[model samples]
Target: MNYTLNQLRIFLKVVQNQSVTKASEELHLTQPAVSIQLKNFQDQFEIPLTEVVGRKIYVTDFGKEIAEAAEQILQQVSTIDYKTLAYKGQLFGKIKISVVSTGKYVMPYFLADFLKMHPGVELEMDVTNKNKVVKSLQNNEVDFALVSILPEKMKVEKIDLMQNKLFLVGNMEEDFTKKKKIEAILENRPLLFRESGSGTRQTMERFIVQQDLKINKRMELTSNEAVKQAILAGLGYSIMPLIGIRREIQNKDLQIIPLKGLPIKTNWSLIWVKGKNHNPAALAYLDYLKKEKEAIIHSKFSWYEMM
Candidate 1:
């Protein structure tokens, strides 16, 4: 079977957009051309590549897997293209990155520094939750993902960058310092919990279950901001990353209570799909991150005590 790089690119684009029309617009190709290319790609395979549901197109599970392979292939081709251009002593391209929501807080600053180092390179970022981060990596939607929890079976490389400590926060009026474990303080208080699939929430739940404590999950929030607001309003207590609530903790609007017998630490990692190709921009960005990882970690943690 024979396939062109352009056809693989069109297939990947359609899967990413979930719409042939959108892929056409992005690729500046006619809708008919997009459809034809997709058809050609499907014909090459033993099975259909996509199925239409109403007006929208959905790539089959197997098709999605093939698209991932195509993405890696395209990435390798792009790497070669970049190297050809690099022979002239110039680097210019885009490096796409995705990060879990919590990572957004610090990733931008590091990215800014990376930009300063390589002015010709452009950076694109997508912020979402842990599950989405993993999905994005698997789909090759982004070159790298910064996240706290690494999934179990993915063929990816993870570099442990920093440790984010989980803290229990309550209204300033409540003093849980006398209480050792989170179970004790939460006995009579309402607990605000982040939604499922959240790294912070997962960490908190694992801690609670490991301690054999019964937690009353009175409320659920989708974001750290909402949880902070709920806790500050005295509606409930919450467990969050210390960095996430640094300001409130320092302003005396919220109090951080230590937990005993609780594993309240999470390791943040910079991850990329294993064996996938990397362009100059991607490599440069990764190098910049590794070089500044220590300084970045130091600066972020230094302010935790103040807050």
Candidate 2:
């Protein structure tokens, strides 16, 4: 009950790093000082927050819950500061965004421009799989998420930012230059699939089912880079977003497999939970996205045709 914000911050740091020593280093506090505050924080709570085993600290289930709460509190405090600055006509605050792995290709340009225009704004970006990004958005852990596949369960306010072209790609050495029918490709070639729960994989599966096509799953990879590498090594062909493989295609390392109904069109969307009150920074960035999306896409990715 007597824990201060500083104490909670130290606790959060410890939870994040899983080491008091590391937390102390990052916090610029002596190890003993960090231990004392951690003890004070734990003493205020009836339940144990963390346990030490083999010289490593691990957060308990209750600790995890508390960490989430602490993060919310910290974010709220940060928002208060942001709001105060906004009242004075200053654009400043931290914006946390999570994007699917493929979005990494394009999202950075937007962030870079935003940061340049609003020099006071701080940005934190998490690049992860679509499932984790969705979870972060659902939990209110991020201000916005960039993704192609929207979750059916969550009530989200989204805008179509751009088109994501999904293409069947293979190694340049493969004889995919010749146009082939979807049915023949699926029947003859081994198909590389993204790991389950990926937005890319989900879209590809839906397309396969809609077209009544069957595939032989040759291998499953977790990341786009991994899947691309597998394809480059002649492991198998995969359906991937054009954003992630543009350079490879340009370099002649990979080639698109022309098939009927290929290049599935999906929208890249900027989304946040419906009814969530966005901070000024988030609102400003959203406005920027709305106003500059076309220019942003064209300026950064002019080489690729916008579908």
Provide the TM-score for each candidate, comma-separated.
0.69, 0.75
Q: How close is candidate 1 to the true structure, as a TM-score?
A: 0.69
Count clashes in each candidate, considering only residues at least 3 apart in sequence or on different chains: 0, 0
Tens digits of per-residue lDDT, candidate 2, 1-307, equal 6789999899999999999999999889999999999999999989999999998899999999999999999989887977787788889977999999899987888778888988769888889988899999989999999999898889999978778999888887657667877657656557888888899999989988888886654678888999989888888788889989887988989988887787899888889999989887889999998898889878887876743
Pairs that clash in candidate 1: none
Per-residue lDDT of 258 in model 1: 60
Q: Say which candidate scores most in lDDT.
A: 2
lDDT of 1 by residue, 28-65 (tens): 99999999988988999888888998987888989989
